[model samples]
Target: MWVPAKFRSKVLAEPVRRPQLIEHSSDKNKNKNLETRPQQHPILSAQQHSISQELHGKKPAVFKMPVDYSKWDALELSDDSDVEVHPNVDKRSFIRAKQNQIHQQRFERKNKIETYKYERVVNDGLLKRINALLAALESHSADADKRSPDELMFMAIMETAGDSPNEAPPPPPAGVHTQEKEQPTYSKMMAALVDQVKAKVDEDKPENRFAAYVEDVKSHKAKVEDLQRQLLEELDSLEKEEGRKITSENIHTGFDSSHVTKGKAEDKSTGEAKKSTQKAQTVEVLNPQALGKPLLTKKSDGQQSSGADADADEPMGGDDDDEDEVEASELGKKFASIKAGDYRTCLEFISQHPEVVAEKETDGLLVLAFNSAIDGAYELARQCVHQALLLQYCRALGRDGVRMFFKRITTPGHQAQKVFFDDVNSTFARIKSRAKEIEKQRAQEEAEGTGGVEQIQLHAVDPNTTINIQIPPENSSDPAEIKAKELFNAFPPGLQRALESGSLDEVNKVLGKMSVEEAEEIVAQLSEGGMLSVEEQIIDATTEEGQKALKEFEEQEKAAQQEQAAEQAALSKYSDDPE
Candidate 1:
C-alpha cells in the first residue's frame, strides 16, 4: 500500500486472486481514461488487498496515517520554573544561597585538614587504596562500555554473520566476484572471462629469483651482526658505570671512633676517686653531633648539694648561663607556671624574660620544654607523675617513651608547645626522610640490577670478557684436609667425632643452636630412612621373619625323624625275613 510511484506498476502486475471490480462510466459515453493515480476509493483499497494476498501470501496490512506535526497547542501549560514563579524568590537569590553553602563546606574541609595530625601518613594510605581502586574502576568502566547500546549492537551484527572470524576477510577486487545472483545469466561472458585469464597466465611465465634473494639476505645478516656488536658494547659500558655507583654508595665513613678512646681515658682517671663514694648513675643522652651515649650522671641519694656542688656543675654552663640568684628564682617560677599547662601566662613571661626558655637544662632538652613534657603541661595527660628528678629521668624515658610523649601531645597553646613540638619532631623527621631515601636507593639498585655482594653467581658469562671467579686464592694443597679442619673449627667434636669427650650438656647446647627448619629436616630424613628401616626390622621379627626361621628349623627336625623311622623299618624287615 505504501510502495513508491516507480514501484507501483511492478507491484500491480502480479494479480493472483480475484476481487470485486468497479465499472467506471465517463460523460458522453466516450472512453474516458485508463491512467490510474492515487485515489482514496473503495475499489483502490480492494485492489491493494488483492495484490497483498497474491504477492506476499498474507492479509493486507492496514497502514495508519501520520499525525499532523508542527501544530502548536495554544492552551498548553509551561513547565519552566521561572514562569509564574514565587513573588519573593528569584534566580539570583537561589544562586547566592548555593554559593554560600559551597563556601561553608570548603571552610569546614580546610579546618578538618589543619586540625587532623598524622595527615601525611593517612594520605599515603589513601593514595595506595586509590591507586588500586582506580585500576579496578578502569576495568569496570571498560565492561560498561562493552555492555552499552552501541557496543551491544556491534556485537549482534558480528554474531549475525555466521562463522565470522575475529578479523574480517578483505573484499574481492572490483571485477572479481562482481556478478550478483539476481543478474541475468551470461554464458558467453563467463566463457570470455575464462579464456582471457588463460591467455594472461600463459603470456607471463614465472621465473627463478633465488640468487637475488640470497644477496639481500646476506646484506641483512651483516647489518644485524653490526647491531649486535653495538648492543654488547653499550651493555658493558652501562654495567661499568652501575658498578662504580654501587661501590660509591656502599662505602661507609664518619664513625665516632674518638668517643671510645675518650671513654677509656676517662675510666682510667676516675678509677681511684669515684671508688671512695657511691658510684654515679650513668644515663644515655643525645649529644650535639646526634650521637646517643652514656654522658649524663646523677648524684647519690644521700648527697647534699652545697655551694661547692653548684660550682662543680657551673663549669659545664656557657656565657648564656650567667643568671644571678634573683633572676634564676624569677625564671624558675615562670617555668613552673608553664609546666602547670598555663601556656598563655608563660608565653607572656618569656617575652619579658627570655632566658627561661633559652638556658639548657642538665637533661639536654630545652629547660622549659623538658618541664612541659615531664610535668604534664598540656591537655593530653590525665595524671601528673614524675619518674625521676636527675639524670636517670632522661634514661628512664627511653626512645619509645619519648615517642609516646610526642604522640600524646594535645593543643599547642600559643608558641611554647609549638616550639617544643618542632624541636622533637625535627629529629624524627630527619630520620624518616633518610629512611625513605635509602628505600628509594635500594629500589633503583634492584631495577638497575646493580648492588654489592660477597659473591656473584654467573649463569652464563661472555666468552670475550675475562672474569675472576675465584674468591679466596687457592692457598692449601689438600682441599679435603682443609675442609675437615674448617668443620672441626666450626663445631666442637661431639658424639659423631669423639664420643668419649662428648657431654650431654654440650650436645644439648649444639642442638639448641639448630634452627627449627634444620631440626625438622633432620627428623624427616631419619624417619624416612634409618628410623623406618629399624622399625621395619622390629615389625618383621614380631610378625613374619622370626616365624619363618622357626618354621625352617622345625621342618629340618621333622625330616631327620622321618629318615630315621624309614631306616629302622627297612632293617626290621630284613631281620624278620632272615634271608
Candidate 2:
C-alpha cells in the first residue's frame, strides 16, 4: 500500500533497531555469474556483436580474423571489472506508475475544486456578516441622535421586559377603546340605536296636521286649474270678439261681408277661365318655337283659306285708317278716364302693344310720357326714368332703342313723334344746361353734408326698399327690378351725393327735385315703350344660368355616351373573339 509522504516519513524516521537485509535467491546468483563470464577477444567480440546486432538494433563492426581456429583463440582475454546489472523491471513499473499518476492527478483536481468551493462559501458568509454589521451600525448611528425620552423609555422597557429568558413576556397594555366607558359587553348600544332609529322613522310619519295641509294644497291646485280654465275661456271669447270687430271694420263703403264673398267667387271663376285660356294659348305658341321647326308651312292652302274666311266674316263698315285712328283715340281716352271697369281692358291693350310710349323734356327735366295708366302706371314710369337716368349719367345704355321700344308697349296710344321728337329736341338743350347747374349745387351740398364716407350708400343693399317711388310688389314686377338697378346706377354722382346728404325726405328734393311731370313722364315713357328684342333678351337672360347649366350637363352626357360606346366596342371585340 502507498502511504502519504508525511506518514511514510514518520514511520521511516522511527527506524527499526537493525536494518532489514533482503535475501537474494539462486536466480540472482546465476545472473551474477553470467555477468562475470570472461570477455571475448576483439574478433570474438565483433562476432558476438554481429550476432546480437538484431537485438541491439545496430550495424556490426568488421573484425580481422586469424586463419587458424584454435581452442586458445576461443578463450578470450578477460579484465576483472566490478559491474552491476539491474534487472529489467520497467514493464511492471510502467503500469503501476501510470495508474498512480492518474490517481494523483484526479486527487489533486478533486481537492482543488473542494478547496475553491469551501473558500467561496467562506467569502459569501464573510460578506453577509459584513453587510449585517454595516446595517446595524448605520441604524444605531441614525437612532443615536434622534431618540426622544419617551421613545428611549419605551425601547428600554421593551428590552427589559422582552429580554427576560426565564419568564413569559408580560401581556401588552390594552388598546384604547373608541366607545365611552358606559358601553358594556352586553351592548345596549344596539338597542339604544334601534330606539333612536325608531324615533327618527316616527318623525318622518305624516301627522294629522300634515295630512290636512296636503289636502288643502290639493284643493288649492284644483281651484287654480278651474280658474285657469275660466281665464282661457274668457281670453278665447275676447279674441273672437276682436276678430269680429276687425272683420266689420274692414268692409268697404258699399260692400258688405256677404257681397265680398260673392265678389271673390266671381273673381275666382273669371280668373280661372282666363288662366286656362292663357295657358292653352301660351302652350300653342311655345310648342312650335320650342321645336324650332314650323308646325305647319306658313303658305299652306288650308291656313290661307281659313284666314280669308275669317277676314270676310268681319264687319268692314269703317275705313281701315279711320277705324285704327278711332281705336287709338279710344284707348287714349280710356287712360284719361280710368275706371275699375275699363282698367283691365286698358292694361290688356297696353301689355299687348307697348310701342306708343313717348320721351319728352320739359322745364329742365326729362319726361317719359305714357298714354295710359292701368292700376300701376306710376311704377312703370319710375322704372323708365331710372333707365333714362342711367343712360344719361352712366353712359351705359349706349343709345339702345330697347328701353324706348318697351315703353311703346306699356303705354299704348302715346304719340311717339310729337312727344319724343318734337318736345325732346326743343327742350333738351335747356334741360342739359339746367342739369349742369343742378349738378354743381348738389356737389356743393354734398361737400357740406355731415355724414362721412362710411355712411354713404354706394350700392343698393335691399333693392326693393331703396327707391323713393312706391311701386307695389305686383306692379314693380321682374322688369322693374332691372330698371331700378339701372337707374340707381345712372344717377349723376352729384345727385346721388345730394340724395345721400338726406334730401331723401322728399322725392322732389332729390331725384324728383328736377320737376313734376319731368320725372314722372320719363318713367311713363319707359313703361309704355316696347322692344321685341328687349322682351326676348329678358326671357333669355332670365333662363341663362339654368340654360348654361343644362347645356353643360347635356355635353357631359354626350361625352359619357361616347366613352361608353368606345368601351363597348373594345368589350365587344373580346366577346366576339372569345380567345
Highest TM-score against the true fold, candidate: 1
Per-residue lDDT over 1-579 for candidate 2, one digit per residue giving the tens place of the 0 to 100 score? 888987998887884442223336857865565434333334446566465553444454556876765534323212213322346655545556655774565455444444434334433333333333233333444454465422432343344333324232122223322233432311232233324433543566544322332233344335445655565565555444434322223456875455321223554586588667755543222112212212111221123211111123321111112211112222233332333224345444444433222221110122332211122354433333333332232122233554454355347566742444343344434444555565677678788893322211222233222333322132355785656544433333333334345434432333322333334443443233310011112123357785775576568779889999999999888886756
TM-score of each model, paired residue for residue? 0.14, 0.13
Question: Using alpha carbons, what is the TM-score of model 2?
Answer: 0.13
- lDDT of candidate model 2 versus the reference: 0.38
lDDT by residue for model 1 (1-579), tens = 499999899888976544433555644345344224222235457766556554654455555798864433322222223444356878666666665774565455434333232233333333333333233333344354346422432342233333222222233333333454332222232234334433443455324222222233344335445555565565455444434322223457867455321223444465445544323323232222111111111123222121112123222211112332212233343344345444345345444443333333222233333334334342212111111121123234553553343334334475634654464456434434554566688779889989532221121132222222111123566665454333232222221222123343433333343333333443343233222121112223466876785576568779889999999999888796755
Worst 10 residues of 1 by lDDT: 382-391
How far does residue 230 in candidate 1 sit from its true spot (Å)? 64
Which candidate's lDDT is highest?
A: 2
